[model samples]
Target: MIRVVLAEDQAMVRGAFAQLLDLQPDVTVVATAGDGDEALAAVAEHRPDVLLTDIEMPGRTGLDVAQELQGEQTRVLIITTFARSGYLRRAMDAGVAGYVLKDAPIAELVSALRRVHAGERVVAPELAMAAWDSADPLTPRERELLQEVTTGASNADIAVRLNLAEGTVRNYLSTAMAKLGARNRSEAANTARERGWL
Candidate 1:
């Protein structure tokens, strides 16, 4: 049997996932966690072969949990409601074996588990498209600037937050706008939000 651990903040969602996975003939729900800290603890205690987790939860994020548990012995499958492109990129970078949207049919979950177990990478098709559409080679400074701008900060505010001169902040923003093909700061912010790059 494929031993599985489920981690989700919502009780109903957790229960539904547990029930769905349990119904699989070759799978077993070994444990369940209501938060990231509990998810890590459950993985340590149960040593399940696979962990299915939601991205946002109390204590630690699912990405944090995945970073902690990534290894040969156990695999992580991220299940999230929001299909944020940045989240998907970060999850992939964290070495999660699978990514599934919460609203995906149960069959997708089962197939993801099977694929992860078989040493295959799995991501939602829509998410894959979003990733492809949003792909841009961003410098580290540009990424940081974009993140700061997403918080609704003014140029001076961003400079203060990043401990840079206001002129430097403006320069960074201009460069970022050029790279993203945005006409202004607001447009740049909107583009980043749409791509989930923030």
Candidate 2:
């Protein structure tokens, strides 16, 4: 049997996935977790063959878990509502076995999981194409600043949060805006978001 651990923040979704996978003849739901930390612990405890997780959760992201477990025994499969190019690119960079949208048919999800368990790469075609079409232009620090800006934080607020000088925050914003060809920080944020770069 293919022992699997499922992790998602939504209780209903987690239970539904577990029930469906458990009914499969060749797949077994060995464990379930509500967040990344719990999922990691469950993996350590069960040492399952596959991990199916959501991209965003309260504790940590599926990307974070995949990066930590890459090259390990358990293969990672990301099942997320987000189909953004940035998320797809990051997942591929982390070497996840599969990345599929939550809106995909149940049959597709099951097939992808089986494929991932068999050591095959599975990615949604549209998301892969989007990843190829768009690229993340911001540096790590610039991305960080943009994330802060998206939260409606001002330069002073961001400076205090990042512990950088207000001038430095403004510079980072300016550089990011220039790179994105945006007229202002809001425009930069919108551009980055549309390209899934944020």
Candidate 3:
């Protein structure tokens, strides 16, 4: 069987996918996780052939986990609601093998998983053309800061959480705001998120 680790935040979606994959004669969901951190743990423990994940989750994004798992045995296949081309580019840069939308048919998703396991790249046709529209301007640190900014956290609170100095946090946020053409931290965070950079 093609062992898979399924990662999605929504319990219903996770359960449904696990059930569906289990029904496939050639596929088996070896484990399921409700968030990115949990997904990482499951993948580390199971060493599955593929990791099927959603883009946005509670802890790390799928791209983050995929980036962390680069050169490892597990191939990652992203299934996300966000259709932004920036996300596709990021996933490609992170070395994920497949990028498919959540609305895609189940057969396509399964096929994509198989293709990824076979060491083939799989990206939705609609998203493939726009993947090079422009590179994401923010660095990984900027992305993390912007994510914290979206939580409406004060710079001091963010600094405390991220273990960075408050001045450093402010500087990073300011830089990100300028790059995104956002007038403020919240706007910057929202813009980055809208573009699937965060």
Best by lDDT: 3
> Largest TM-score belongs to which candidate?
2
The 0-to-1 C-alpha lDDT of every candidate, in the order given, reads 0.87, 0.91, 0.92
RMSD of 2: 2.0
Candidate achieving higher lDDT, 1 or 3? 3
Give the per-residue lDDT digits (tens) of candidate 3, residues 50-165.
99999889989898899999999999999998889889988988999999998988999999988998999999998887676667899999999998988889999999999999
| All-Cα superposition RMSD per candidate | 3.1, 2.0, 2.5
Clashes of 2: 0
**lDDT score, candidate 3, position 70:** 96
- Give the alpha carbon lDDT tens digit for every residue of 1-198 in model 2: 899999999999999989988888999999999999999999999999999999888868888899899889999999988879998888888889999999998889999999999989999998888888888888989989998989999999999999999999999999999999999999998888766666
Which residue pairs in candidate 2 collide? none
In model 2, where do residues sit more than 4 Å from their true spots? 151-153, 160-163, 181-183, 190-194
What are the runs in model 1 whose C-alpha is more than 4 Å off? 58-60, 83-86, 152-157, 181-187
